[model samples]
Target: MKKILLSAVFLFSALSYAQDVKFGAKVGLNISNLSGDVEDTKSLIGAHLGGFAEISISEKFAIQPELLFSMQGAKSEYSESDVDYSYSEESKTKLNYLNVPILAKYYVAEKFALLAGPQFGILMSAKEDFEFSENDNGITDSGSESIDAKEFYKSLALSFNLGASYSITENFFIDARYNLGLSSIAKDYTDEFGNSTSLKINNNVFQFSVGYKF
Candidate 1:
């Protein structure tokens, strides 16, 4: 990992002298959800802030690398009823990550660019808040709780980014992107019999942002 980062830095430095380089910062809205091994899931609203360097490779091509702090997760609700009892639960999971993405941008038109990339994320925190209610033969109970869930997830995640950007002015732009997870974010568990099982959850996110170039 260190060697790879060093090589990237060297390459970026070399390219900076040969092409136009732009540095910028962006803030965005994130709509995130968890998929696989979970039911009744919905998107969670979050935010991301980032900085990037864009190096123009040609009249229509560029390479952009970004470092971002992102908040992502999902919300779920479940309910069941029987003649003797009824139960319901709602939960919200929050995950925080430091993300690095190296993107290739192709200008399809003077003001529009298509973007694709691989995003690498390092997990920072995981937590969940849940509430439950139960009724049994006219008896009722309700409760809420919060749990630290970092240990249940893996430390790293890999995802693919697909998006487009529209330059509104010389130094300003707006973009929308979707990140599709390629690696499972949940950890596996080993049993005494030497078998391993996992929840097989992945993170999916849609991002909308406004940025300025300097």
Candidate 2:
């Protein structure tokens, strides 16, 4: 993923010299979640800010490359029951990432365009905040904790983007996109019983943005 992103940057740089390039900055809202091998997860609200370069290759086609700082993750609640104890937990996971997406844009109309691309992400930080309660026989206990969880996850994430952009005016635009996860970001773990399990978690995000071209 790193190599692919690096090659794309070089390609974009070369194209910038011959193409009609327009640079822009954007700020956005992200509705994110986690999917795969997990249950009881809810969407988490986040934000993303980015810069992009659109290189026009023709009247109706262009290539856009973007660099963004994104916040993503999910909230979950679950319970476990056993003969000796009953336990319930609620957690919110927060992940920060630096992402690069190289998109192909097809102008469907003069003011509207469709976008599709591959996004490469490097995880910058990960943390989990949780509250839990356990009842052992007749005894009850409850607590909450905030922990750094970066080491438990893979540092690289890969996703595919599908969306559209509308040019509201000559220098202003609005975008709506869905980023679908294509790679698992969770690492394998060993349980207390010494059995190893491979965890699968992927990022699912919906984004909306407003931008101005410079």
Candidate 3:
């Protein structure tokens, strides 16, 4: 990612400097994950749709900020290790949020800039499910014991971001960034047989995307 940042700085420098603050919109893809007690081994492609503004501080520096609707989460498998038998199950978690990122851009050339900042996200929705075991002749154990279907969004998180951006032209740019969650998402859980439990959901995010200015 640092390599990408370096390249972005050079690209921005080669472009012509603008007198007015630039404003535009962008839509791109995101590869995300959820960290913590439950391992999010599987990563899914999500979307980043937003608009941004660039106010030139000088010939080589600017304040860049954006507001976007981002979709993120993780996919994983669960199994019974505490039970008498061994079995596995699969699950998917989908989290939707409204994210705001404010960054400082340092130009290396003219059109390429290095970007870093703090990103704040507000939770909108969270959904999850578990797959059933393949074995038969046993009672269907509801995974509820391991998962609490309620109070999930109480985990809304905040994170720090470091990234890079490129201006393909004076009106369009593409950016890539990494977001490290600063908060932990804790949730109430119910075990299979009937047990109350708690698990901490890690909010770390690895994101890469492209955007354009109007």
lDDT by residue for model 3 (6-106), tens: 53463365234544587888888878787777653787668878887786767887777678888887778766644445577777677777887767789
lDDT of 2 by residue, 65-166 (tens): 899999999999999999989999999999999998888899999999999988889999999999999999979999999999999999999999999999
lDDT, candidate 1, 1-214, per-residue tens:
6644764785576486546888999999999999988887999999999999888988898888889999999999899999999999989999999998888889999999999988889999999999999999999999999999999999999888999999999999999999999889999988899999877899999999999999
* Candidate 2 local lDDT, residue 96: 96
The TM-score values for the models, in the order shown, are 0.87, 0.85, 0.72
Identify the superior model by lDDT, candidate 1 or candidate 3: 1
Best by TM-score: 1
Candidate 1: residue 12 lDDT (0-100): 73
Clashes of each: 0, 0, 16
The residue pairs in collision within model 2 are none
lDDT of every predicted structure (CA atoms)? 0.91, 0.93, 0.70
At residue 208, candidate 2 shows an lDDT of: 98
User: Which should have the higher TM-score, number 2 or number 3?
Assistant: 2
